[model samples]
Target: MLTIGKLGQAAGVKVPTIRYYEQIGLLPEAERSAGNQRLYSRKALDRLTFVRHARELGFTLDAIRDLLSLSDHPDQPCAAADAIAKAQLAEIEKRLARLASLKVELKRMVAQCAGGSIADCRVIEVLGNHSLCAAEHGPRESEGDS
Candidate 1:
């Protein structure tokens, strides 16, 4: 059995994140050592690795939880998993669209700058007046990404 620290090291996740996963039920409650430190098995290490990979792929905790549940029941059909992946793909596409729009607006903001005083700065001018922006992105910065 590996200690929590070792497990975290092997899984490329922080110790606190591992603890948080445990607290959130993404990871199983770890067994304790003689001094009450958390001890983990190889299975725990593998699970942590899976979680880290999913997180790197931008899977939310709830999605990861569902994927884990599906993992636990291997006999279940893969429709749910495929649906989750499709949803994630759709989210990614939305983010890409938002990013592309942001890029255009930013480019316009930069290109319009004549390098004069702040009062005449195109960057500040566009920023102060959202109406000047070409993209119709919403007020919140996290609208489409979420």
Candidate 2:
């Protein structure tokens, strides 16, 4: 049995995250002691560990719920789980591509700056006018209010 803080420390998760998982039904409500302190069994620890591992791998809460549901039914086909993994991989690839592009553009921008004053700074000059920028900037740069 442990207090919430002790449980969080043991599980390598924050206390609020544990509460969030509980609120979202990923974790079952723990049995309370005489002073209303939450207690856990080894089973709860295992479940929380599973949930924490999934989250550390970047699975969204909704996807974690789906994975948990799939895990509960051992006889189910694993095609759905495969699809989720594929989606996450695709997202990671997309982010990597975007980051690579950003790196290239930043290098190009930095090359233009020669430690001049702000009025003559090529970096600021190119940024203030996208038409003057050599790099084909993406959609994330414009329409800030949206």
Candidate 3:
């Protein structure tokens, strides 16, 4: 058995993050040593690794929880997992489209600037008056859904 610190080190996750995962039920509660220190088995390390990878891939805690549940039953169909991945892909695509629009607007604003004073700056003007924008590049209704 490994101590909590060792488990965190092997999993490349912070100690507090591991604790948070446990608190949120993403990780199983760790066993304790005779002295009351947290002890973890190799299985815990593997689960932590999986959680870290899923987090790096931008999966939310709830999605990671769902994925973990699905993984626990390997014999089950993968359609739910596939659907989750597809939803993430759609979200990424929407963000990409928004970013592209922002790029175009920024380019337009910069190209229109003649390097005059701030009062004559096209970028400043457009920013001050959203009506001057040719396209809607503002935040979406679900901007902070993640």
Q: How would you encode candidate 3's per-residue C-alpha lDDT over 70-124 as one tens digit per residue?
A: 9999999999999999998887888788878878889999999999899899999
TM-score computed on alpha carbons, candidate 3:
0.86
Q: What is the lDDT of candidate 1?
A: 0.90
Candidate closest to the true structure, highest lDDT: 1
Of 2 and 3, the candidate ranking higher by TM-score: 3
**Candidate 1 worst ten-residue window by lDDT:** 137-146
How would you order the candidates by TM-score, starting with the best?
1, 3, 2
How many clashing residue pairs, candidate 1?
0
Q: What lDDT does the true structure give each of the candidates?
A: 0.90, 0.79, 0.88
lDDT of model 2, residue 73: 91
Give one digit per residue, the lDDT tens place, for model 1 in 39-102. 9988888888999999998999999999999999999999999999899989888888888998
Off by over 4 Å in 1: 138-146
- TM-score, predicted candidate 1 vs. hidden true structure: 0.91
Best by TM-score: 1
Candidate 2 local lDDT, 5-113, one digit each (tens): 8878888989998888888898878888998878877777777888898887778788888888888898989999999878978866766677777688788889888
TM-score of every candidate: 0.91, 0.83, 0.86
Query: Which stretches in model 2 have alpha-carbon errors above 4 Å?
Result: 137-146
